[model samples]
Target: MRWSIPRSDAVDVLREQLRKQVRAPFAATAGMVVLLWASLTPSLMPRTALFQALLTALCMLAGYGAGALAGWLVRSCGGRLAGRARVIAWRVLAGVAGIGTLIVLGLSLRWENEVRDLVGVDRVGIWHLVLTVLITAVLLALLLGLSRGIRALGRSIGRFVGRFLPAAASTVIGGLIAAVLIYELAIGVGGNRLLGALDSSFATINQEFRTEIPAPTTPELTASPASSQAWEDLGRQGRVFIASAPTAADIGEFTQEPAQQPVRAYVGAGHEGVDIREEASAAVTELDALGGFDRAVINVVTGTGRGWVNENQAQALEFMWGGDTATVSLQYSYLPSWMSFVLDRQRAQDAGLALFDAVYGRWLEIPEAERPLLVVSGESLGSFGGEAAFSGAQDLATRTDGALFVGPTADNRLWSRFTEEREPGTPQVLPILDDGEIVRFADQPEQWDLPGAWEGTRIGYLQHANDPITWWSPSLALECPDWLEEERGRDVSPNVRWIPGVTMLQLGVDQFSANSVPQGQGHQFGTAPVYAWAEILPPPGWSDERTDELAVVIGDRAWLR
Candidate 1:
């Protein structure tokens, strides 16, 4: 101790700081190894030497500062107080190091708002964060426990070693133990963090594939003609994005006919539905809130590009495109459901009568007073079921009351022709999310056209202007000059439909993205307003005067809550 000299010279300062840096990291590493071995570290550490250095340095700084203070306080306290103070000090220091480990884990995971205030906007990859947290926790817990053990064992070691040898030998033994701890710490770090960090950070991250999606590959969004003009590539409305493919064909089983009686309809047996058969992608997503119905059926789903009926709680019907690990893009929802193919009109008639008899037994044969209200609704396939349900309800001697048809190219035309007229109900659309906040989108009429199929019928349209998914193409909206500036019936609300809710949910929110190219705006990115049914626009970004028929944010702050 007398031989050692303390100096404040620049050279000395650098030397001391360097030594602390070097030794502290080794100390920290040794602590971590022991902690990890003890199953007490908080998170998994990066397998790089640089990451190890950073971790070791932090732990060392915290541990040493606490240890020095404790040593000082103990010297002053002189006895039992010193021993207790030492324990308390180590506990506090180790606890802090453990917390630091958690913070590191948050960084690794990259979810900025996980703690909201602590981290912002960095969505850490889920697995990495989890792994890091687990490892760090194990490390920290082990360190704390080891510190306690060290305190307990140090005195015992001193007494036993001192009795066996000369006092000098005891000093040698203590030094050897300290050296072994220090050596273990020095060897544990894996070191790539420090190396790669020397190069450009962005380069490293890009090369790592740890940030951002790779460049574009979709033909619909490449150097082709489609990329030349401004076109919505994929449109995501809520959880659904119905991007009209170049290969779009009449996937609907029914054919379209002109509207009659203000709301024309078509009727087909078993699978005759599509009234306004236009093609884009159509789908339905039953999310958290929409899980209200146990037996749920979504008509004209934008994602599946087909009608879905969930009879029992099982997967919906789908077009078969075989593969393992289906890309959500190509086959969004490929469900399995029962379907009967009627090869000819005669088959439909035969099945219709026989099916009617069976359905009649359950629907009509049951006491009319005992039956519950039936909900009949559909676009294409949905319309077929609606018709059968309506007919079945009639067979049961209970008149089918409320019926709504969407994209009714067939059913609406026929249903309107059959129904006897009564006083037309004034359209009752509700905007519950706001007081008087109105969202105006171009291609969407002033009053916003409700599906024409609603005329002379109790129809409810869950629409946001021209939903391209149900065939109201952006091309149609664009062609209809002053589609926005026109009166309600002439352009927007066409006399028979209503909106029960204003705010609509994003189908697959943050998940909405398109394969992008290097060229600016070449992204036929699946933007909601730009392509899909629910042209969802974010809060107050698009103004009143601007009308692109794009989704505009219309609700109040409370809607978020």
Candidate 2:
């Protein structure tokens, strides 16, 4: 009581306390900036590209400014909710926010007719999505609470370790332990549920929409030299659909000779959804049985949610080759391809390796003179996985005769590498590599107008400029990709412009809407498959007229999704 400070000293002490109080919001703002920067840096910032780096820096700064604004908002509202009245007010505010969110979601559901058409579902499914979001939010809150407890446990351990070790070291160890615990919990509990919530309702309805295919009849299987023992055996071997070339009598007027009849074999990934490798092995064996050695074999890897090969591509190959080609494929996953990639990319990659390896192994056994030219093809997520079979152009050249990956995802490693390392003046979407020798990217067949006869094993990627699958990436949240500046795909809206975060969010929505348009005309590549295949494997007697004719036929035919 006797130790009274001087007035000047007391004023200084008060100022210090005020400064400390003011520091809290600024510190929080700094932390937010760090978090957002760390999250976005991996996607936005490329090591070599100057524009990407500069743009990423700007994005980081913008995020920091947002964080600052949030900090100010938090500080302004800090002491408003203190007593009983404040508590009640908070409850009212939360209720208002919830109602507002629901209203917004309802409006969105009403506005997004294109998404409804694309997904081929009704309002009930949209309502399910709303429920999914709410449930997911609740689960996330629970996880956050659990994480807090875990973090406390980690801190307690750190305190204990502090007695035995240096403070910095103990703190680091504790943080690492906490991180590991959180990661394990995320995987062990939340991973499956989180993924399922994305599209489970839609997938359920989609599965219901699939038509039940009948197994091959005894008469059909035993139909003389025209009937394939392998094709008939597929029914017993558990394939979903086996469409062998119809005999002369079966096709009636449409029948060309037995030599011109193509063999198409496909097996489902079980209605129950079993292992991919086993199914792939089974598909390879079926390919072998169905005269794969005698025909130019195209082993296609079907996208997730697709139960069959790209019918147009397969049919085009058969048509171009005069029925001297066979296509084999198997279902890998039941979830929609976009969802599958988000949930379990490794499965797709594994399927690609297993199927390709099995076919290549079998293909090797045949004598060089008699061995059919082996080719690989895939589309969308199918392309992403199929590309995993090769490390680069050299690897592709050595492994397969020719390959076609249509609508390739931006993350495809080989595609990215090739595009990045292409010769100068080459466009990002359709890069001409090594004078169109090893591999070339193409938006259309006309871009492949190289001088003289094209040399080397051909691997073409057909990515439409407008395809969301080809361009969507986390980086779009910050900066535009080069593809946007160059010639846009025929279908892409001219009004489409890159607006940083807005564009990113818009494209995410566009992914759902893309399927509303007809295939080939949009991302599905409609009649483009016939043209693409013709370029990749120029069959004997193939002409522009023939390709155009087949394109028309393929467009007219119904294909299984």
Candidate 3:
């Protein structure tokens, strides 16, 4: 029922197809135009020349493919300009693309400087722009060459198959086969190997110590002289966490009153043959030994992938409660937060649920009146894990005295639900849910103060407007988020425009530099926890001035570790 090409004719057809595969000059010009537009688009953070080059090159490649496909479709539909008209069209497009690219580059430099000013970073010079152009040219050439090679291979397969089948059938079948082979080789096997290599490398790094961070000697800290957990057993981050706790002296000096030593218990992921539940149990044992349950406040904190608890969050509560606090955490993975967010997110959820349940069960054993105020906290991927332990806002409010989740990832179900159901007229960045009765979101310290009488179990989410961790979603490739459509956040550039797939790429690259900016912008939450905790559950007689003073103190000493 199907006609197949003869072997000799198929060879000739293949040659013609390969020859015609060469992209028209107009296609490159179209790509250049799109590349310029992508370069000028505003991002969450001010990018370095290297990052700018990468962004532009990637967008240019996408544009080139699109333009080439459009040309192919036009030709297939029997559309063609005459010799003189084609030449004129090419010249006009070339002129427009060239002039447009130069103008956009000039505008991009100004926009970059503006972003730097907003984020309090140093500005880039004209050299940066020059470097971006050079690097982009190199990257674009390499990408185009690779793309052409892949296309050629696919076409060759189709041509070979055309000797035995119809042209359309051959092409379709060849494309499908090539796609499957590429996916299997590149992702199924190569991706797994790459992840394994990265995991091994990061695991090695987790065992090493920072030059500045020595193991703790205090009895109240885990991995100390009197502790059951060994110093060598604690991973790098766990060691840093134990060593960075505020001492009685540090808290006493700030409060101008005698302070108790804060209890800190951490279980590392590096322990051999131990599951998450056992790790959590060991943490509870350490907490019990350190008299954590006897403290005025107990924080069941979730650490990021490398077991990094924000010192600001931990020390803020210590200083606020005059060191009468206990904080416990467990490491889930050796890979950094970003890597674990993609590969090992389920481990984080398991760790959070196990640790919180273990601690909550112990707390329940004590008399209701004698129980300390239990609070839950985490940041970024940590927040994603922490939210998994609870079903929704009601579960969080009922189970814990208060909670402060900072820079929550877009995957956090409770956070997404709250943001989606936020009151009308409220912005997505700083949503006011249920009139701030139980749960609230804030971009700054001052936004915590809501009107009317505050009720039970206050929960707060500290999110920056430019925090890519909180805003990035897969849906970004197709749909514009409400945050971009509404009145922009104070830190976000007004020039930011969402361009379907291009905006997704922009935000994807933005994640790398999220924490490179100053404390208030991007993913950095400097001194925000001090105010967040103050509003959630301030100590007796706590005042705005006191919160201000503590913020200053913590800002000075928090990053010492």
Candidate 4:
């Protein structure tokens, strides 16, 4: 028979539990401190005044929010259990890190196209991601638990005391002040009312990013979109679309020997996609020099004084992805002189449009209306030029009676926006996979990852396995944005084995570094990540067991094996 304990005794037992919970984190605290110290790589330069001020302001506002979360946690979980929570958190973080390491290893080890296709490997394998999450949770939990223990021990909270608060409150207050200042004093600068005064802030914030390019010999640098198209149109029949992207040396980095190139890629071992940063107008000049294609889809190769460059090339190809294997590209021949962080992007988009248009016009001249339509598609930007080119093809397909859309970010807005501009329900927009399978960041902020009617259309999301730009967003990751359960064809979530190439999105960015600076330090994140072709694709039709010898052999370095 057990004797009943007094209320004081019960309280003491509860206290002991809390005390133990609190101690676990404390025990790990020294390890965490050592780990953090080892991982510490401070910024080379001093924090800017604005960054400092903002940080301070953020710290102030966060105080309240942190207090609230802390109170809530303590109340809900019983403060004594905090140590256990922290331990669990650390364990989770360790798990995630382990997973990430494994993913990296798997991707480098057992890689192939069919594996990429059927098993669904991406840049970071799912296991790797699991590890990363575990690591993050574990690290954070360890910190939290240690803090709780320290506080219970009557120690000072230190700088981190501010982190738990509501960060947005201070930001809102600061933004209001800044907005008021701009409106009153900076009116003329903001005159374009179209691109509000706030636009410059984004530019200024992004200006610190750096990209190293070899100095051009010609001071009079030019980027003619039409001209660029003419120069590159020569590669359509069998010219692999080697990455036109230039490295710091300002030279096309095609794989050395062609046949030994990677599968599903243009250039050789150095990586397939190009990173040319010429002027927006360069393609026009190149096209003019080359004498252009005749009949095209959206933009005529030789426009009878007809239209601007178009998006037909990509549209036509995507129109027939599995119909007949074809490679497409948007590149610049001569690096442009008028290059900036921003203009590099615009020119690439324009040049690509011109090339596609030229390609389309060539198709038109075939005069064989009986040609079984090859699938056509292209990735567009979140801006005007890409929208125009994409919309042009979309419109034409509707008129012609056949077209399809693929890629991570399909144009769902094309329906509502295009309809509003023209007649209601005038243009036909058929998203083979409803707006749900895989949504892009540029498409719609609200509908990301939401479920839609599942249709088992044979769809392929060519997500370059480890293209950093396409993955690991601080904002989107929290949402569980893509579908977890497969509704249609095989689950196409890329992993270590399966890899997506970065040719398309890389074209849209100006400088590779320009796209990567927000999250990472320098601009290294902007460049496209590579994978092996033989490694990424499903067993191509050409091969029996191994990847098609000729294709994978030739395209060897084109992708990462």
Model 3: colliding residue pairs: none
Order the candidates by TM-score, highest first. Answer: 3, 2, 4, 1
Residue lDDT tens for model 4, 1-561:
999999999999999998876443322433333233212111111122222223222222233234444544555565643578867866875775467545543443233223333323232234533453345445455556644443443212222332553544443444445445556554444444423332343223222212242212221111223122222222221122222211222111222212111111111111122333222233333323333221122211211000111222221221212212233333332222112112334443454355445445544555576332322333322122223345543354432322222122222234224322432322121122334232122111121233454222211222221222323223332332222112222222233111111112212221232223231122121111111122112222423233233322223333210
- How high is the CA lDDT of each candidate model? 0.27, 0.61, 0.87, 0.29
Could you arrange the candidates by lDDT from highest to lowest? 3, 2, 4, 1
RMSD of 4: 17.5
- The TM-score obtained by model 2 is 0.64
Model 4 per-residue lDDT at 283: 38
Better of 1 and 4 by TM-score: 4
Off by over 4 Å in 1: 1-361, 379-381, 384-398, 404-461, 469-485, 488-561
lDDT of 1 by residue, 446-542 (tens): 3333232222113222222222122222233124312223333211223212111100111011011111111111111112222212222111243
Instruction: After superposing candidate 3 on the true structure, give the runs of residues whose Cα lies further than 4 Å from its correct spot.
Output: 1-25, 160-165, 210-214, 271-274, 558-561
Q: Give the lDDT of residue 371 in candidate 2.
A: 79
Residue-pair clashes per candidate = 71, 4, 0, 109
Give the per-residue lDDT digits (tens) of candidate 2, residues 1-561. Answer: 598999999999999977753332343335433432332222210111222223333433444445555755675567333578756755664575467545644544433333334323343336543453555445434543554467578788788888999986786688678778777778756887776554445434434422354444532222124334333233221243343333323222222434444566565543344467777777676665655556765545555444434566666676666666667766666566777777777767777777888778888888888878888888888788888777888898887878988888888889888887887876676677778787877777787677645666788888766677777888987888776677654545333456657456445545664565555434667778788888888766768887777777667766433
lDDT of 1: 0.27
Off by over 4 Å in 4: 1-282, 294-388, 392-482, 485-561
Give candidate 4's total backbone clashes: 109
Give the TM-scores of the predictions, in the order they appear. 0.21, 0.64, 0.92, 0.32
Which of the two, 1 or 2, has more lDDT? Answer: 2
